[model samples]
Target: MLVTHERLAELGILYLEGTSVESIDRAAHAVILSGGTRLGYERLLLATGARPRIMNKTVEPKSRITTLRTYADAVAIRSTLGPQCKVLVIGGGFIGLEVAASAVTKGASVTVLEAGPRLLMRAVPALMADLIRAKHERSGVRIVTGANVKCIDVNESCSAVFLEDGRKHFANIVLVGIGAVPNVELAQAAGLATDNGIMLDETLATSDPDIFAAGDCCSFPHRLYGERIRLEAWRNAREQGAAAAANMLGAERPYIKVPWFWSDQYDETLQIAGLFREQDALIPRVLGPRGQLLFCLAADGRLVAAAGFGSLGAIAKEVRFAEGMIAQGFAPKPEALANPSISLKLLSSQHRSSL
Candidate 1:
């Protein structure tokens, strides 16, 4: 619903609906379609995105067992949720937790199985993970951490998720949201360089000069972090597409936007800006009873990242200010960051003045 064929046509774009590109002829600067149609292009951009990681080969496709990746998958999952539904979610990451919350909101009995030691162990700090876990538990969601799933046995009406330690949880619906893998097969088959994803330089150009890539399928070096990172968020994908288009038109600009991510579960919202390392110094800013912010400072005291968990109204503004500080490379004193009385907006102003 965001864009229509008419809109694209008005923009002088040729919309090829429901046609798959079979292969790329780099030397001819053309692509072969599914029906053996050859389409030539001066410049090409691959926004192939990603696919949900499957649990294992032993898990066969069933009506009751599913993975959420596309709109259709979400619709299918929603149709199966109700008061009588018993939902079991595999993985405790963002997608799993969000789906669990939605299922619980629909009066479904929900249980989450996470292989990690704690929920969100790779995404956020242990303290933040604990807070999120507590909130979910309070909302009637059963969470099992350090859970090693052996296999899923599906029957006629329900599925049983078996664990390594001789335990099984039966549910009417089983949702898998472990993670995602970039769609790099096409890029690789075309003789393009790929590592984790399609490798791109700072300008989002692929190995072939006439071709480029953006979104989840591309991995570009981040100037702020001094390393290559691929983001699967919607905002990043949208911005990267625009940037890639500009670069294709000879703009010659480097995409250096700071990374920002957010998730909504029940009445709580979690926001993170920039990348945080385990060894980074964490400064806590307590915001009364319902909100808290954690600032991650690098070894040299630079504000590298920030995370906040609470109501949207309580934490959104503060996270915005912190994001600005991180983008500006501000290094406020640890004491100033810890004290809620010292406004982050004021600190941001001071940082701008110093620059």
Candidate 2:
């Protein structure tokens, strides 16, 4: 849904595409910012997302080393690929794998090199990572984990990558999906305090109370985790935007929701419905040959989060009852979770409404 042009238009938010903010000045009742053009607002929100981090010391901003952050980036890569093309993807994270899968489906020879030991190592457990890697490998996508890209060699008509192990991989095109750095220069220039991301309170108000920031650019208080986190997920961004707007209108509601993220690669669709630390114990179960579910239960047995990679209905069911499951440490018996009644739509409506 993220890359879908239809969903992009459905959001209906004012999107100033391909523009970089030049400056921002925030006052009590009004704000002014420059993005190739000047924009004035009574109450301003900085929803500027992040940009992909380029690691190649040699690759310039405008080069064959492309980073996927917008529809244009995807379009550029799609238009450039042809049958029997070789693609070298740097960073085996979600973005990298998704791009590789897309290219492989279009008849490209894809290879993903991850600096870590496993794909999505930081986002999921080792076993889950193995499952994702296996799934991709079955689709003819070669995965090289624990491999680092030392430099990118771009010449007149071709590009190649040099790995730390002195191995070279030639590619018709190169895609760097290392990760993202928040677009907070405007907020920083306006004197807003920022650490990993823009620092904000429970009300989504920055250090400068006159200005509020949301989406991927802001970090705010999280009640469940008992700390502030910078979340870059779509659901978090949309909810935070609405919360910031409400607080600006004197509602003062704290932005408190379990951060959720989802990814679709080839035939596998993965959904994560809550937040859990690295140390959280995951209770895994296989519902069928095609459906798998993981419940992250706390030390006390409360369900902290649910991750699944087969059935959206099943995943949504568990997500809806997430609070009760978390608070009470409840885990459905093996047989109950297998039942058809555990649907995502029903559970989401029943459980999520209380929030």
> Whose TM-score is greatest here?
1
Judge candidate 2 at residue 119 and give its lDDT. 87
Predict model 2's lDDT versus the native.
Answer: 0.75
Task: Write candidate 2's Cα lDDT for 30-72 as tens digits.
Answer: 4433534566766677888888887845454337787898888
Residues 1-355 of candidate 1 have per-residue lDDT tens digits of 5789889989998888899999999999999999999999999999899998887733665444678988889898899899999999999999999999999999999999999999987668888889999999999999999899998987768889999999999998889889899999889999999988999999999999889999998899998888889988888998999999999999999998888889999988999988888889999898987888999999989998999999888788888999898887888999999998888889899879888
Maximum-lDDT candidate: 1
* TM-score versus the correct structure, for each prediction: 0.97, 0.84
Measured by TM-score, how close is model 1 to the native structure?
Answer: 0.97
> Each candidate: what lDDT?
0.90, 0.75
